[model samples]
Target: MAEPITLTAPNNTSYSQPTGLFINNEFVAAKSGETIETVNPFDESLIAKVAAAGSEDVDVAVAAARAAFKNPAWRGLSAADRGALLYKLSELCERDKHILATIDAWDNGKPYQVALDEDLAETAAVFKYYGGWADKIYGQIIETSDAKLAYTRHEPIAEQTPLSVLYLGTLIKEAGFPPGVVNIINGYGRTAGAALAEHLGVDKIAFTGSTTTGKAIMRAASVNLKNITLETGGKSPLIVFDDADLDQAVKWSYVGIMGGMGQVCTSTSRIYVQDTIYDKFLDRFKEYTVENTTSGSQFDEKTTHGPQISKTQQEKILGYVESAKSEGGRLLLGGKPGAEKGYFVEPTIFADTKNHMKAVREEIFGPFVVIQSFSSDEDAIEKANDTEYGLGAAVFSRDIVRAHKAAAAIEAGMVWVNSSQDSHFGIPFGGYKQSGIGRELGQYALSAYTQVKAVHAATCSGAHASPYRSGIISRNSSLDRGSILQAGDHVSPSKRPGAKA
Candidate 1:
């Protein structure tokens, strides 16, 4: 049996005061003075009350952001200077990593060490990477005919564009955009989220969360045609080939699915194994889970998996397990929530799962896995790409050529070879199909946040009329040099050096 982890509100801690909405670098109360109580998902204990930003508070935040964007101090700063601020923020986050990690553990219900090490570290890296690119946003110059010059100017789209809502606040601290150039208002999606997305002033909206909500944001932004980027839900697949390193594949699967309580959007929820090694792989995978993972609190280093974000989530995962069994999916291991005070579920695995079952189709968003066997490579690709989501997928194989081929055929924005759940800062992360629009991360991320304009200069000394009595003739004649450059020295036969009349 796993033990319950408990947390109580500390009177002496800095967080004793309720955390309020962060707007314009200041925390303030909502207009209605409404608030929501954050409960520890583990013990259902009162953690802290967060201000629920109503329409009025959202208005204030947007207005403040607008002011900052227009202000000379922020708008006039060079991109290099802006990036430096992000670098500073990253340093500050590293200094207080321990404290922030604790907050995430207590509020988000993930392990303390992971929150500190992986989440916080990655958050800092994200900021640093973007910061480095701040000054590097560039455009291209194109050559034209007749001394004409043209170039494209890459510039910030507008003031206070809400590119995304970093629900994971740690990512926000890591994004390092200039204060006014990138504003984040912390509030529920129904209120603040909706306002930011639909606000006429906002140029674009980028969101990462459940698909159900992604549609809502799209609908709201549609009214204004506000540019949108969504990194939505995913039912990612992991294909284990017959020639794979079985031990590593099984171990990596365990880490990917069970590490974050299976809360990650790209977590490998669906595992497809070649028939030759199906039973063997299952044996090792189940053994690893039983020996390693345990349902428990977020603070314990001994526990590999913790409670879901809340009780509702716990019920949802349990429901899927039942649905899977009812639909003829064989439950290989755990299928029930642990008998404990917290919202914890066992590290469950199901075998012989059908393609159409809810567990296999929907994003379970909990610690659960469904397994099915594939007889051929084509079948494995078919099974993996069956989901509507094309967010991410993984393949394990010893042959490099086979791995690359499988990775290419997998219908996902990103694919992993012989590994799972590893993400880097410069690599772009987003999905194709229903996974969402626009990439986030690296220079691609910055591209989604900006727009482009072309600048052209036409130098001409007028007053000399065209000999053909047409000004457009000069435009065509001037193109000869450009055409020569573009198409090589292929002059007309009449103008050839030796054959010319």
Candidate 2:
């Protein structure tokens, strides 16, 4: 293999890049020797050549994970040890923050600074937060008979790797986790992803991507009844009341749609403003969006918005803009491709959009937003909840009580009052309705990664009767009508009043 090459960022920071799949604590090539070119979105230059895993390779990775899960060397480790390893991984990420951020920026088409300061920072914080929870995963004891004891144990799901999940496998290895405990395989959704989801050995699948893809995974997982946690696409709504601070609402709304190049699943693409200040807000919102959203290279220090992830995504966003215009929506500003090269689209805004418009209801997954006017809070709520998606919603109002009420009424997994896209490591993140299934981050994420198994044990030698044992009873007996033995009244089946003896 060639020596690792260091690339310099716009800020003069250096990063050493990885070009291979990480599996069983080692960087290796795909068994089929297939490769996928990782391109820099800014110039479409080859950043690295990643090993493209196929179904066979996925099987190998899954087998390794299964073996490791069964091996006491990993599964038998104390929770404290597991937590310590995660903490070590967090530290390693912190030390290599610059390199990790550069890699993400190059691959994902996000600004370098934003990747470093926000995405990488949040990732590290997530590891640390989950690390603290490793030893605290406790189960409740049921109030059964004193002679019987029942408790639960949380166990990690085996295998089931994701496309982007390979990025974290190196960190797991660096943290001194046992080999095979966390395996990474990279490939397209049809091959490697499908294989992982359908593999019977996999106990669970935690997926974060488009709703269409999430549905596919769910279907595949159903074959084996595997546990699934999906965080899917969204068409979240942002409501700006007349009582809201216009400046704050405008700024936050801009950040909500334009941030991450509108690639976030929870981007508030559907915006509603109270009719009283609708025109005024749109004017300022358009001006602010045009002035602030600077699209260019990911490494550019002044670039607030980077190029879309790929040519297809850029075309997709542009297509949505065309659809919006075709639907009679008025373009307020920026409805064209970037003047320069690369997959860049200007931050686009549309007004006079209806709830039924495709651009307003669907997830464009780009720097595009649709704005509409609402007569009152009820109207805004109705419009926001009109879509099938219910991932996230935001309410901007000076009246705290009204804002909270509006937020509560919105049909979404998350609600923000006078804010947008502000997420925390400890906060549970997920969606409602078709947006996703189950929650991620915080303690809720632990539930996704683990399975709950209950155990019942008999504490008394004479109380060894099986809970499912059949019995006979009489009307005069202390046993309940359902044949359940009353507390402190265990009756032998043969000694029952209606016994055949």
* Residue 239 local lDDT, model 1: 95
Per-residue alpha-carbon lDDT of model 1 for 1-501, expressed as tens digits?
111123342212233222455555544566677666677777888765556667677677667778877888778888899888778767767776666666677676788778888988988788788878889888898875454567987777511111112222333434444444444454677877888778877677878898889989998888779878899999999999999999999998987788799989999999999999999999999999999876566777765677888788889999998899899998988887775688888889999998999899999988899999999999999999998999989999999999999999998999989889888878899998888888988778888878888876655742243433423345356553322223456767666534545
Superposed Cα deviation of residue 475, candidate 2 (Å) = 11
Clashing pairs in 2: none
lDDT of each: 0.76, 0.83
Q: Write the per-residue lDDT of candidate 2 for residues 100-213, one digit (tens) a residue.
A: 777677777889899889988988888888889989989878756656777888877711112134556666777899999877777888888999899988888889888899
Model 2, residue 346: distance off in Å is 0.5
Worst 10 residues of 2 by lDDT: 158-167
List candidate 2 segments past 4 Å from native.
Answer: 1-15, 158-168, 464-501
Residue 332's lDDT in candidate 1: 89
Error of 1 at 83 (Å): 1.1
